[model samples]
Each structure stands twice: as C-alpha cells, then as structure tokens.
Target: MATKRPRRQAVSTCPCGLAETYEGCCGRFHRDEAAAPTAEALMRSRYSAFVRRDEPYLLRTWHPRTRPGRLDLDPGMRWTGLEILATTDGTPFHTTGTVTFRASFRGGTLHERSRFERVDGAWVYVDGDFPAA
Candidate 1:
C-alpha cells in the first residue's frame, strides 16, 4: 500500500509586493473574508490569485463582460514579483479606474495598463492592454 506524504507548509508572502504577509494581504480577499477597498487593491489581489493559481477568485473578480468561460494557467510559468507603476481614478469614489503594472515571471515581465470598474459597489477587473514593443 502507498502512503500519502505529509504536505509541507510554505512561507507565504503577498505576490502583490505589499509589505505584509499573504494572509494579512491578498489571502483575505482570496478566501472571501474581505472585499478590496480600491481598484489598486483589487488589482493586487488579482495578481496574487494568478500566482497562487486561484482560478475561482480570478473569475469571481473579473467583470462578466470580459471574463472568459474558463481560465487556463501555465503550469511551468512561475510568477516572481509585481510592481505597480501608476494608477488613475481608482479611488473609492470612482466608478472606473486604471492600473499600470509590471508583473515579472520566470521568463519575462508583462507590462500592462488594466482597466477596472465598480460593479455593485465592488471593484472588478474589466480588461487590460499590453504596452507596444
């Protein structure tokens, strides 16, 4: 009979480049313990979700109009870090906003300007545009 090996506990850090632990940062959003207060927060949580491969969270936070029927994550690609470059109008009072960031992975960096909108008082990712090479 084969025995199940014990799962190792991995050290957690916020993939969004926040100075807090994963649980204190993006983990709360992933577990539905809290809603992101701003568009930037939502973006951070979404990036963290990509790193953790939390497909459900990503789908939940994505706007219905832009969300795909399913998500396909690249298993061989490892996310390394995130750098928020700039944000515009993503405040608590704004209905729409944009976030420009650089998400570094194993191969290279993905630079994008993502658009967001508040749906029913909750920020949701709408879409994004990659910078021209």
Candidate 2:
C-alpha cells in the first residue's frame, strides 16, 4: 500500500512585497533563470534572498570587490516585510544605482541605502549605508 504524502503549501505573494507569486518573481532570479534588469529589481531579489536565507544567491549577486567570504544569517530571525522608499539611476541605461529601503523583521526594521553596479552586463550589489536615526 502507498502511503499518503503531505501536500506542499503554495505561496501566493512574494516576500519582496510584489503582487506576483514567489516562483514567478524573486524565485526565478534566485534559481538563476534570469538576471535582474534594474538595480531596484536586484535589490528586491536580495531582500527576498535574506528572507529565505539564501546565502549563496546573496553572495553570487554581490560585487566581487565588496563581496564577503561568507554570510552568517541568524536562524532565529524572522523577516516580516520589505519596503522600497527610493531609487536613483540603477536602470539598464546606467552603470550604477542606489536603492533605499526598509526591511522589517519580527522585532525591528532596518533602513539602508544600498548601492549597485553593473558587472559584465549584470546588476550586482556593492554596499549599503545605514542612515542615522
């Protein structure tokens, strides 16, 4: 007799505050099926990566000059949401861009202005600056 298998719950909305499903949104980028066309898109995908604890994706998308050797994500941290406040020139026409956003966790929110640049025609994260409270 074959035993019953547990059903997988489908996620309707993406963690990056997008209306599309995860698989169609950031999941596609995370799976390396496509590259983010704009800096904001890359920023959104990076946020989703943090929410999902996808360290490899994070590292892979980081600029080599600034990429860390490894990531140390806290297993206990629960990401709640991501809110993009502003974006400056990280479009396909520009080589560099900045995305200011707020990423909320279970306890608090992290606000940052992240930088991005194009390397080999692909958008990659460089670094970020935290504004004073």
Candidate 3:
C-alpha cells in the first residue's frame, strides 16, 4: 500500500509580518481594495508582493522615475520574514519619506533604507540603499 501525503495548507499570515492575515493586510492593497496610507505600509505591501511574486503590483507601486520596465523575480528566492527598523517623515502631510528594514530570504537577508514619495496623493517607492554587510 502507498502512504498518503498530507496536503499543503495555504498561507494566511501576511508576508510583511505586521498583520495577522494576508487579507487584512497586504492582500487589500494587492487586490485594489485599498491603497497604502503611509510609506511603511507601502514598503510592507511591496515585501508581500515579493513573496507572492506579484510583479505587476510591485511595478504599479514603484515610482516611474526609478521603476524598471520589467521585473525579473528569481524563482529560487523565497522571502521568509520582514523587520522594520525605522521610519522618517512618511506621514500624510509629507511628500517624501524613508523606511529602513530588513527582509530575510531563504539563504540571506537584505537590510535597506528605502525612499518613497507621494505622487498624486499615493505613496510610491523611489529607491533603496543597502546597508554595509
């Protein structure tokens, strides 16, 4: 007789590590139900996009000045976690902001200070600088 294998369950937790479930968090933004209200939120959503391999969402939220025409996500890369370290001037009143965070992948971690700007009342990722390893 052959042994039965357990079925893989769907992930409920948000990849950004800030929400209890994907639907209550990044999924809202990904599904076009809501827009990120702050730079931190946008950053978190972007991280979730990476985990889901949603290149269109990533590109849509990226600033046009720095956004690439196409995104080539590595199939071997798996995002494991995210840790936000700091935020600066990302309020609704602010036009530019920065968010520093660490994103852990399958075999490595990325530490970056990302820049964002409000364009047409929507927050968009501009660029990021990696910290020294």
Top of the candidates by lDDT: 2
lDDT for residue 84 in candidate 1, whole number 0-100: 91
Instruction: Write candidate 3's Cα lDDT for 1-133 as tens digits.
Output: 9999998887678888975789999999999899999999999999999999999999999999999999999989999999999999998889999999999998889999999999899999999999785
Q: In order, what is each prediction's RMSD in angstroms?
A: 5.6, 3.8, 4.1
Q: What's the CA error at residue 52 for candidate 1, in Å?
A: 0.2
**How do the residues 5-124 of candidate 1 rate in per-residue lDDT, one tens digit apiece?**
999887767889988899999999999999999999999999999999999999999999999999999888799999999999999989999999999999899999999999999999
Number of clashes recorded per candidate: 0, 0, 0
In model 1, residue pairs whose N, Cα or C atoms come closer than 3 Å (at least 3 residues apart or on different chains), thus clashing, are: none
TM-score of model number 3 = 0.89
**Candidate 3 at residue 111, lDDT?**
98
Off by over 4 Å in 2: 1-10
Taking all chains together, the TM-score of candidate 2 against the true structure is 0.91
Error of 1 at 107 (Å): 1.3
- Any runs in candidate 1 off by more than 4 Å, and if so which? 1-11
Model 3: CA > 4 A from native? 1-11
